[model samples]
Target: MLKMAKKHNMCFALIKLSQTHKQQLPAWLHCGALLRTYHKLKDACLKQIHEVKSIKDLLKVSNRPTTVPHHWESHDCICGLCVSDRLAGCKNPHKCISTVAVIINNLTPKFNPFYCPINDGLTLTHCRLEKNTRARTQHRGDIIFDPSVSETLQLAECFRIFAGDTRTAQAPAHRLQRPNQGQGQQEPPIEIYTDSSCINNGKNNAQCGSGIWFGENNPLNKAIRITGKTQSNQAGEVAAILIGL
Candidate 1:
């Protein structure tokens, strides 16, 4: 499909629309060669070398009987990952591990890299992406590939929800109806109040949340816990507005 897209002058959006049901094109097509490379590393290297069965395992920090080794001393570790980290001159091998996990778990919007075992290993790339600045932006779930079909589907569904796709039952009504259209009655104005909150505002451990109040007991009401790069009240406010819209 990607070959056909390039061969004929097809817009990328059209390709995405084609795979909206199947979920084949979006992430796979977006990642392409990088996807292949990561999978190859997982299958041919990480699995064989470190016995990684899941993203959780893959992101696990290297724990020796002694304290974690410095980059220069990584050559003495048991795993090839450490040796490679040393060769790459990485000051912290856990950061490298976190990076790989983030790439693979691409579909999760609430992915707190810190939630992983290696909480202190967030890479500079993760930090930059979190800012959501025009200078560096990425569509969160557009570059994931997983061997498990069920897991992939779950991730895709999560991405769709976080991205405000409203096809699912959990979302509010898909289309709002005008009151008394046949009688030419104008639709009444519906008011919605939105707000955001954050704990430990400037700290790394800060948690942000947003709320949408349509009415008491209204199905449209939502309480959202924000995650990822923009873990701030401002971001939560923006998210609340977008979701409400």
Candidate 2:
């Protein structure tokens, strides 16, 4: 009925009809704008749906809690810490006690092979890589040691050779060769001693140095010392052993 208007003002008035005139307006006029808005909203929803190809993708896009998703006891929840962070070795804060705390508390302790600091490759059964990044479902071995006993004070098996003991340092030495009694060969034992010193053990600007002593029981023996970038005790120990060997 409003299309019958002859003046421009009359057409504008018809387009801006009051609430009462809405009931009488042509149905097609109201539908065009509504369809456009509905199409825009539907396109946005479809775009979101198409972006997600799998459940994992959907979860990645979801708003999740910052806390751990599963109720796992890092040490004893029956699920070990390795379950999180893609098996890269569980770094859960809860486990700092049952694990590193033993060392801090000056007690003798064994550890889960996955978190075993130096011996992960030897203790973790499934450590197949040259790097000890992954651990097996079952551990390989448990190393027993006492922190109360100092490495220096402990009676090394090697010194027993000088005491006229018949047994050797190691039952089957990997680094030592046996002297044949029949050959009556007499060769001086080679000693390679290593030690590390840190100016400040755990500070930001700490300094660390390692000392290597190589030679027989002679006054002419010499020592070499080296400084490293990191000042950590572990880093120094590892460096000393690596360089000494």
Candidate 3:
């Protein structure tokens, strides 16, 4: 009983001191065993933190579908997503809403696109294409992503509901809506075949490169450099296709 009480007090003390100016780290830092435990949980915490961050990244992308006629005139329907329900269900409503707002407002053309498999369609680049064209990249899942304009307002809703801010909270339900085929016409996609290869497999230093093959006699053929940290055969192959795209 005494040992349990001591442990409880130690945790409470750590919490209180963690917020201090940080001239000194919490004493727990000195405990290698404790750090090992923290390392074990690091992946789970990173996963959750990344999911929340993805909501913020969504704001940096454009919501307009470039292929749609008069895309500039069309209002993003994703913006209509209601957050009142999410707020009502949140235990820390104020923090959640505020964090979400910040994340959702970051959409822009300069943003780098990424995928979060755990997130809804509102955050996916595939969903940002013309409604009918979304199918072309549907199977790519979170692997292939690019910044786009389409259903951006919905991103705000997603951020508002998912951001925990400084507190821990469960996010409400959300999902990417199916592309609603609008009357607008779509631009044709350019087609090409991409491939990659690497030499010297698990050796001291390997050479890897990506390549794009357009057609039997097409002149747009070339090899791409993908050498940095990834000297593996698969990384080279994947890099080739991504570069081609």
Candidate 4:
């Protein structure tokens, strides 16, 4: 069955070619001649080759058709679907569309010339052919997300949320070491450092408040407030730490 189908396809293709080039073909080469050749080839295959259950097995016993030439691979060329070997040396190559169209129309009985496969396989009943052609020609790249705007905004919002959660209370005493008074107990002099800055210092958009406790027992027993120009609340917090240090 597979062998028969392949033979039938080849015969149909040859018939299509012969009918298309009837006027240009030699007197001896015609449909009758092709039909006789086809029968001889078909008979030889049946007698010499064993029957195959599938197309793949049939291909093992048959010679495959040659590939379409490079020039005829693309749809934009003058050949427009016709094989290169069929159109060689034609004077009015531009006028080959009529011959090509006839062959295609016969070979692919299921194809609808008025429809576009990309348009959901629908028949192009009312579409403008010129516009569709231009659109297809101009298509370039696939659509993708634009990361510049949305990504930047999301990052900024996240930073703002994090900055709002800074500790507002005074520094814990556990952070500092205890003072020593083995001899006559005299209290160590308290040295307080203070500075202030804003997150967006120059812009005055957001402000950050920070204090440190610094002493002998307390690492930062002396409290300091840092307030001034800053880019972010984090920067203001950093400034307060520096002042305490």
Query: Each candidate: what lDDT?
Result: 0.48, 0.35, 0.39, 0.34
Better structure of 2 and 4 per lDDT:
2
The RMSD of every model to the true structure, in order and in angstroms, is 24.2, 33.4, 21.3, 30.7
- In terms of lDDT, the best-performing candidate is 1
lDDT of 3 by residue, 36-124 (tens): 32332322322243232332222222232333233232222222221332333322323333343333333221121222124443444
lDDT of 1 by residue, 1-245 (tens): 64654455443221111122223333222322233335543343344444455434534533322344443333255455576645655544554454455454553322222222222222235444455443335544333222221122333443321232222222111223455567756667989899999998888888999999999899989999987976877888999999988
For model 2, name the residue pairs that clash: none
Error of 2 at 65 (Å): 91
Q: Superposing every Cα of model 4 onto the true structure, what RMSD results?
A: 30.7
Candidate 4, poorest ten consecutive residues by summed lDDT: 11-20
Better of 3 and 4 by TM-score: 3
Worst 10 residues of 2 by lDDT: 107-116
- Clashes (backbone N, CA, C under 3 Å), per candidate, total 1, 0, 16, 26
TM-score for candidate 1, residues paired by index: 0.27
Q: Which sequence of candidate numbers ranks them by lDDT, best first?
A: 1, 3, 2, 4
Better of 2 and 3 by TM-score: 3
Which lDDT value does model 4 have at 121?
23
Candidates in order, TM-scores: namely 0.27, 0.21, 0.25, 0.15
In the range 124-241, model 4's lDDT, one tens digit per residue, is 3334445556566888443332222111122122222222212321111121234772678777686665444455455656755666655457755544344455456566567666
lDDT of 1 at 165: 22
